[model samples]
Target: MNVTVKYFASLREKLNLSEEQLTLPQGVNQGDQLKAFLCLRGPQWQKVFQETGPLQIAINQERASWQDIFSDNDEIALFPPVTGG
Candidate 1:
């Protein structure tokens, strides 16, 4: 199925693109798995999926657990965690 993946902030700089439309294999049913799958695309993907700081994820504008699931047309976004002073 096809889904739109959006990148924001530092992630955009790292990935070098704002978004991508991909047709993922059927086994990619969860958010974290999707993250791992994207990493397989190359070094950029690896950075985005890094276990450390900066990156955060949302689904249709709401925060998602790393294990949250997704559907064929789901909209996923990647961004850095927000901070306020």
Candidate 2:
């Protein structure tokens, strides 16, 4: 299935893209699972998303937890915690 991923702030620099269209395998349905899969890409992905920096996810503009299920064409946005002004 195809999904749209959006990255913000440091995450965009880490992956080197603001957004991307991903074609995922069947078992890659959950947000956490998807993160794990991305980490498998290499050091950049692993370090940027795996060990450090808490990344927030929004599924179709709604806040989503790691266990949230993703569907085809879903828009997933990733951003770090926001700070108050």
Candidate 3:
């Protein structure tokens, strides 16, 4: 299935990308599974996705959890935790 992945805030800078379309492999249907797939890209990705603290995820603009499943054409947004003074 095809999904659109978005990066925001520091994650955008770290990944050097704002968004991209992904063709997910079979059995990779959940948020956590997607993360694991990206981390396999290399150390840079692993650092931002694996070593970093909790990230916020949204599926189709609604808040989503690691267990959330994905569907074709879904939009997944990943961002760092928000903080306010």
Residue pairs with colliding backbones in model 3 are: none
Per-model TM-score on C-alpha atoms: 0.86, 0.91, 0.94
Q: Flag regions of model 2 displaced more than 4 Å.
A: none
* Model 1 C-alpha lDDT per residue in residues 1-85, reported as the tens digit of each score: 8899998887788668999998999889677788788889887667666843756788888899878888888899988788889
**Which candidate leads the pack in TM-score?**
3
Clashes of 3: 0
Which has the greatest lDDT? Answer: 3
How many clashes in each candidate?
0, 0, 0
TM-score of 3: 0.94
Arranged by TM-score, best first: 3, 2, 1
What is each predicted model's overall lDDT from 0 to 1?
0.81, 0.88, 0.92
Candidate 3, position 26, lDDT = 96
Worst 10 residues of 3 by lDDT: 47-56
- For candidate 1, the C-alpha RMSD (Å) to the true structure equals 1.8
**CA deviation > 4 Å runs, candidate 3:** none
